[model samples]
Target: MAIRNMTVATRSLDADMTVDEFKEWLRRFDTDRDGRISREELRRAMRAIRARFTGWRSRQGISYADADGDGYIDDSEVDGLIEFAQKNLGLKIVAY
Candidate 1:
């Protein structure tokens, strides 16, 4: 397996303080004020990153990484997917 050279913020669900922190970040992603993140939101975010980061990766063969298989990336999904949006989208991640 190739080593992914990326600085993704992923926190273990088992660890303290991280799980909650991630949940908060995820909330920002969901702009509809919906309790869960819908696939549309994920797709939009995915596309936005691609537009800014030329050569950015798309949601090509990955499913679970984006969110729950049902289409929503809920609080429960946060624990496992610690990958950076840039890595997942194959784009340059910007913090600002």
Candidate 2:
């Protein structure tokens, strides 16, 4: 998946959603509207996209993956995350 000439791995989504984009996406996943995205919440949202992604959320430690701990990912890790979200999580927008 290459965006803007950046040869990156492929993921499924309308486009490569960044961690920050994912943060907002997380909000959609949190159907309960709980402000914070739990594993279960992530699972629910991911279920529509892919069942595999749920575990990655837990495996990668969502709480810690945020890096600065600002409750979001805004850097390189987005690539890995995109893979997890697409392959494991099951996103339906961008096709990798």
Off by over 4 Å in 2: 1-14, 53-96
Model 1 C-alpha lDDT versus the unseen true structure:
0.44
Off by over 4 Å in 1: 1-25, 51-62, 66-68, 84-87, 90-96
Could you say which candidate leads in TM-score? 1
Q: CA lDDT of each candidate?
A: 0.44, 0.50
Name the lDDT value of residue 38 in candidate 1: 67
- lDDT per residue (tens digit) for residues 1-96 in model 2: 323332223324454545545545556656566465555655565555554545666546455444455554444344444555566444532533
**Model 1 Cα lDDT, one tens digit per residue, 12-59:** 222233333444555666889877666565555444433343223223
Tell me model 2's lDDT, rounded to 2 decimals. Answer: 0.50
**The best candidate in terms of lDDT:** 2
For candidate 2, the per-residue lDDT at 72 reads 40
